[model samples]
Target: MGRVKHNMVKSLGKRTSSSVSPTDGSKKRSTLQMDLEVLECPICFETLTKPIFQCDDGHLACSSCCPKLSNKCPTCAFPIGHIRCRAMESVLGSISIPCPNAKFGCTDNVSYGLESTHVKECIFSRCSCPALDCDYTGSYRNVCKHYYSYISSRSTPLHHYAFLLYKASSTVRMNISDKIKIHVDYTNELLFVVQCFRESYSVCVTVSCIAPSSAKVGKFSYQLSYTVDGDTMTYESPDMKRILKVSFQTPLEKFMLIPHSSLRGDLLETKLTIKKVIQV
Candidate 1:
């Protein structure tokens, strides 16, 4: 089995010989194709990059995981994280690939082990679709287009408010969002997702922006107010969270909490005001 795998790798290397020649004929490069699992740390199963450490018996580990294991090698039960694995570091440094988000408008070529880190910070990284039936995934801009197109046919006409890039403040009437149901609204370029669910005897209303993690839009604060029994109830959040997906399993840290008594026959009429905060 080992010999067959080695022969396969050699075959791949030979296949790239003609293609890797530079136009100027100044140099030749060959692509090494192999299973990436071999480059992952056994402890964390993450790509191994710089500062890799090894045990006395040649068991390797990443730096972040070494301390958790108490500097002991799991394979050989020997002292670890003391000796540097320069060979592995050199191998990792030599291996580079285009960013996984390259097709999504990212034009970076990153080191092999550092691809995961780069993708996390890449603006072009794809965000998951919030809809349950949709399997769409794309960059932030593309995701917005897809979301708008998907909901456009079934969407009710909303009161459009022009949100200024520098300063924005708007108060709008929000229709009742059924219990444990999702409602999506758009104000200018931003999309707002609202969800309401019965929690014990109270209703929990959560509102968030469906955007990329690195969106440059300024911070937003909101105030939700509703009238019940001729009295007014209000909930305010200093900052609204941004999410890539609609998640019901995780409890939101900030949300509007309304008592069951505030409901008017399974209906809740609310008014929402959103303002963008300016940073000095």
Candidate 2:
């Protein structure tokens, strides 16, 4: 009976040792797996790219991860400020990222550091051409051209003319007709009159009896009348004079005159002149 008891005890000891070995092994394997899975940023499930360290603690996070969190860590409530993590960042710098919008149209994949910039400037970004039935897909410049063509096609028929005026010793004369246009003149204000029809037009009229250095000289006002054959529109006031003088100061390159042809009906002829300026 003693021998039987002895044998049973030995068997039980062997069984216990066997079971303990596997448990210890399994625990070690599990720990290693967890360590392999640890990554810097929780926001992006991937390994940290462009890792940034917290100011309060030496905790590391991904660059893409920090913005979503409050200025502190929820775990420690440490005031998290931006600090570079050279080690983690170097690791992330080696990673390549597929374009986030690859499914939309972008075909290029770039390093994680350059991903945001490339995506922002991607040419394949979806944009609609405002022109009807024109399904054009290209860069920004191409899209601009498409809109320009649309405007030109829809433009109303109009004529444009311009003349250059040079200031002489005693008088001013029109040197050459730079441009002329049939334009729709809206109400004439002191500074500008809204013209509707023409694509471009300008007229140059010279002012005489002005001192070169005097800032107040050569100021004048003129009543402008628009008459096409018999139909007439007249605007006369001190304001009209101010508008013409202002036009002279404006660069010719920036000048745009709206034409009458762009209007619904009837053409109007117009005459403009400078009245006088108070000598200073």
lDDT (CA) for every model shown? 0.65, 0.39
User: Relative to the unseen true structure, what is the C-alpha lDDT of residue 149 in candidate 2, on a scale of 0 to 100?
Assistant: 51
Model 2 regions more than 4 Å off: 1-51, 55-72, 78-84, 99-108, 120-137, 155-280
Residue-by-residue lDDT tens digits, candidate 2, 65-122: 4666666665576766467767666544544446655876667876654654565445
- Clash totals, every prediction: 0, 23
Q: What is the TM-score of each candidate against the true structure?
A: 0.59, 0.29
Model 1 Cα lDDT, one tens digit per residue, 99-210 = 8787777799887757656765577777666666678987655666676677665556333222222223334333344333333343434566666777778777776766
- Give candidate 1 misplaced runs (Cα > 4 Å): 1-38, 48-58, 62-71, 79-97, 109-121, 152-188, 200-202, 215-219, 225-239, 258-265
Which numbered prediction scores highest in lDDT against the true structure? 1
